[model samples]
Target: MTRLDAYLNRIGIARPSELDAAGLLAVQAAHRQAIPFENIDVRLRQAIPTESQAVFDKLVTQRRGGFCFEHNRLLSDMLAAMGMANRVLLARVTFGDPPALPPLTHCLLLVTLPDGQRMIADGGFGGTYCPPLPLADGAEATSGDGARHRLTQIGAPGTLPGEWLLERMGPPETSDGRGRDHAAWEQQYAFELADTAPADLVMGSHFASTHPSARHVNCHVASRVLPDGFVSLLERQFSRYRAGHPVERREVADVAEYRDLLAREIGVDLPVETLDRLPLWAGAD
Candidate 1:
């Protein structure tokens, strides 16, 4: 079978009759639901490859998930194989307090529609919107999971000069208790239209996976976007988020439970030996 066929099968979605906006949204949503955003390889000390084939083997063949570099790279490859126009773009993560101005540490896809409009087709960002968002500044898009998102342009305009900030719109009530005001907009990440090369992605992946200060190095994180809510596994704790409802959380009792959670809920196939070697909930309280 062709790569496109393999990808379509991997995401459990039927082949689209046409590569229009509707088909793009369907494929993106299916991918997010099937594949999870995870850093298990980094935690296991396994080398994370940024090459397209390597990523495909791990994600599709092995049924494993990866961070942005691997996830977005594979998505771009699938889109190209299906005759879609796409480009790789880099982004700096600014999700935390006092937003981090780090180097381009995230990779995403910029897809061009037939009508010449650009859309951000990202399958890597955990718990974010699923459908492709229009790249136009101040345009809002909602995902199949009922989460709202938008993009705002920043800095001066030129050939990829200004950065685009992706913001997630929170719920109207303050019951979530995330310490933010009610109905606040959270900054997910910032990116530019500048061209991103494969080497650039490799560098970013290397640093993110191996750097001592990187959060992925110390924390084990896995997240999957579901139809009605989102599921996240951080260390040994698992949390579920549903729209207009309180976040539900619990801790895994032991290593077996953690492994079962990864395999059953996150669709990861980590070997038992690897799970035995790695620390499960070392630093978590």
Candidate 2:
């Protein structure tokens, strides 16, 4: 029998016996607090895992962060062991410049609770909420991270319809002695309720992590949400973004600081051999 207690303990899911909305929130909190969304394996030339056990061994045992494949796959397994029914949904993410990427590059999960209600459970997207969102159109999901996010329906249900967009209103940037106030709502990703296997995700994720043109392979930036601000490590500089304001950045002089930040904030550790190559991912040194 799959042990729910052990898995919950590993992920810090506290209140499994409660099995109510509160319990769901607890599970989501545990996941966000314990697991980190990261792409360190790409620098190490490690093979992205394809099984739930492999993900558990890499994350729980080895203490590492992973891309969507490993992160959500293990999370889904944990949820299933906890007696929750969930569906794996595929999404394409657009982050940096263009805004949204094409479909099939991201993965999310839809969870069905005992009350026959559906929620969005995601642990792989860095800096996202720990709890699932009510799978209802026009419902807003506010996270502990201070981001006001809502899901809007694009098309009719069962038509393989619209996107679940995550949006935020932030202060505008002031440059060259000019001040501007504006609102920005970008689509993180969109997906339908479809089941995706771990093995399948691994194959596609491998290409994205290794492809020379992919944004992830080209940038060494990693971020995690904090109560007061967000910590982002880009190359040697550590930046802090707070409540939609100018970022505070500092250059890291010692390499140990980089490793320590990964361990402390992002919940990851770099292998000894990969330490020298870390700068390669950061496009530094």
lDDT against the true structure, per candidate, is: 0.76, 0.63
Query: Model 1: runs farther than 4 Å from truth?
Result: 157-162, 171-182, 244-247, 281-285
Error of 1 at 195 (Å): 0.9
List model 2 lDDT by residue over 132-242, tens digit each: 678887667555545556666665534432355544433221110011323565455566665667565875687768777655675565556454345666556666656
Q: Which candidate ranks first by TM-score, i.e. highest?
A: 1
Residue-level lDDT of model 1, residues 168-280, one tens digit each, is 76542211122243366787778888887778998999988999877688778887877666777877777776765787778888778888888888888776777876767
| Total colliding residue pairs, candidate 2 | 2
lDDT, residue 8, model 1:
89
Q: What's model 1's TM-score?
A: 0.90
Each prediction's total of clashing residue pairs, residues at least 3 apart in sequence or on different chains, is 0, 2
Give the C-alpha miss distance for residue 9 in model 2, angstroms.
3.2
Clashes of 1: 0
* Model 1 residue 75 CA deviation in Å: 0.5
